[model samples]
Target: MRLSPSLFYTTNCEPALAFYEQCGLGRATILLRWGDNNMPVRTETMRAKIMHARFEGPGVLFHASDNDDAEPMKGSAMMLEFDDLGRMRRPFTRMSEGGRVTVPLARQVWGTSFGMLVDAFGVQWMFSCSNE
Candidate 1:
């Protein structure tokens, strides 16, 4: 069995997908849409919305969708750990832009560089890179 966290986008989910790509995290592959796959036609507003999608990254995976029925996300943060400095630093810098940083990237007691921030879309993230 496997478990994966699901994210609901506030908008059409396109912006969040773009952000993920910009961070080099992953791409959102649209699996299903309201107006496709023989699914019953939803409202005009939802026709273009993502009904189901998958975000796959290096050891990261999650489900995402955009619809009125989705609940707003809060009180949780996505954590990513990497052994490579270049891989971790790029995302930490990109995702922190236009977002509030709760913790700056610095050496931590755990012997790793750690940081936390809330992205522009209000999604929180935590990053840690092992010190070599």
Candidate 2:
């Protein structure tokens, strides 16, 4: 089975989507707005809110949505493994903007270049690539 993680943004899905795109993930697709569907409640104010979105690329596939009650996850992290150290730089730089770096990119004893950071959207990410 193929597993795709879903990310729920409390209110900033647009920026989050853009941020991921900048990190080398493909553009958002299959966008669904809240008011586009027939619901019994008033959704005019939420018409611009993203009810669903999909982001897919060479090494990523995930769903995203704007949620009012969504809370950021703190302990867990999303780790991305790259084929080589060169492939890890650009995305690492882009994803680290305005974010706190818990572990700077460097050569690890395991013979890999690795780094960790919490993105501006409060998402934790670990980037790694084999040095071999």
Candidate 3:
């Protein structure tokens, strides 16, 4: 069995998707739109909303969709562990652009690089890299 964590966006998912891209995450393709398949758009907000999108990066994969209720995003946190410090640092710094840094990336006494932040979408993220 496999598991994929999905993120729920607050209304428009554009900002969240752009944030991920700036963090070095790969592009996302809209699998479905709220206005697709001749489905009726109940509200103007739904017309251009994404019903589903798949995001793929070097070693990342997740799905996201807009939270129709437009409520605050209080989703789960995600962690990315890497064998290369450079790869780990790139995204960490980019994610910090509009995100809240809980912990800046630094070499720990244990010989590992680690950091944490909450993205603009309110999703917490943890990044780590090995000394090797």
| Cα-based TM-score, every candidate | 0.86, 0.89, 0.85
Q: Where is model 2 poorest over a 10-residue stretch in terms of lDDT?
A: 38-47
Q: Could you tell me the lDDT of residue 13 within candidate 1?
A: 77
Count clashing residue pairs per candidate.
0, 0, 0
Candidate 1: clashing pairs of residues: none
The Cα error of candidate 1 at residue 116, in Å, is 0.7
User: What is each predicted model's overall lDDT from 0 to 1?
Assistant: 0.81, 0.83, 0.79
Clashing pairs in 3: none
Tens digits of per-residue lDDT, candidate 1, 9-121, equal 74557778788888899887656777886776557778767778899977889998877666666788899988977777888989988888899988899788898999887
- When superposed on Cα atoms, how far off is each prediction in RMSD? 1.9, 1.9, 2.1
Decoy 1 TM-score against native: 0.86
User: Model 2 reaches what TM-score against the true structure?
Assistant: 0.89
lDDT of 2: 0.83
Of the candidates numbered 2 and 3, which has the greater TM-score value? Answer: 2
